[model samples]
Target: MDIVVAITLFVLALLIGVEVIGKVPATLHTPLMSGANSIHGIVIVGVVIVAAHATSPLAWVFIFLAAVLGTMNVVGGYVVTDRMLEMFKSDKSKKGEGK
Candidate 1:
């Protein structure tokens, strides 16, 4: 069935993502996440396109869930990227804070 295939693919992708990310070094994580964030943006675009054609109630539900999950991914990625960039702030910026 289509649902079965979709679920299987989703599970497989999840497992693969976990496996690949788990082996990355901490220092490389920020750059990798930044790139993945870009991919998440594209996912959002694709989900939007899919949502436009979603007609049935079940179809709409799946599209809604996908859009939400994709948005979370994009937001979380940017948050991580921002925190990582903060680590490299200039000395002047650090001293300017609360002074």
Candidate 2:
């Protein structure tokens, strides 16, 4: 059945996700977060497709949550990446005092 396949894929993805996220080191989290956002973009697309074809109120609710979460992932990732990169930018760049 369709539900069975969906659940199976979800479980597989969840397992793979756990394994992948568990391996990354804390110091690299910021840089990896940007890449993770790109990965979440794929999840966004998958969820959109599922949402579009979704039926029933419960399914819509699930789809909505997934979409919101995915959007947050992307937006938050960009914010963090920008801030991290901002810190890397020299103060002299702003003051026009660089060598």
Candidate 3:
């Protein structure tokens, strides 16, 4: 059934996301975040699919939560990436001296 497939995919994605969060080292975290930002774009497709086909109040609630979570992933990922990149400004750049 469609519900079974959706649940399976969601669980698989959740497990893989947890594993990825656990294993990534601090030094690699920024690059990991950039990659994650790109992944959030994929979640857009899921949002659209859920929005178009949701048939019941419970389904609407689930879809709303999914949309909010997906949006947070996207916004948080970009914010983290931007913050990481901001930390890397060279001394010359700080002095407004970059070529």
In the range 59-87, model 1's lDDT, one tens digit per residue, is: 98988898888888888778777766676
Could you tell which candidate, 2 or 3, scores higher by lDDT? 2
Cα lDDT, model 2, residue 36: 68
Better of 1 and 3 by lDDT: 1
Tens digits of per-residue lDDT for model 3 on 26-71?
A: 8767777686776766696789787898899999998888887887
- Model 3 TM-score is 0.54
Model 2 lDDT per residue over 1-99, tens place: 999999999999999988887676685577677766756666778888897789899999999999898878877777877777666565547667745
Give all TM-scores, in the order shown. Answer: 0.54, 0.55, 0.54
Q: Candidate 3 regions off by >4 Å?
A: 1-29, 90-99
Output the worst ten-in-a-row residue range by lDDT, candidate 2.
83-92
Candidates sorted by lDDT, best first: 1, 2, 3
| lDDT against the true structure, each candidate | 0.79, 0.78, 0.77
Q: Highest TM-score, which number?
A: 2
Q: For model 1, what is the error of residue 50's alpha carbon versus the real structure, in angstroms, after optimal superposition? A: 1.0
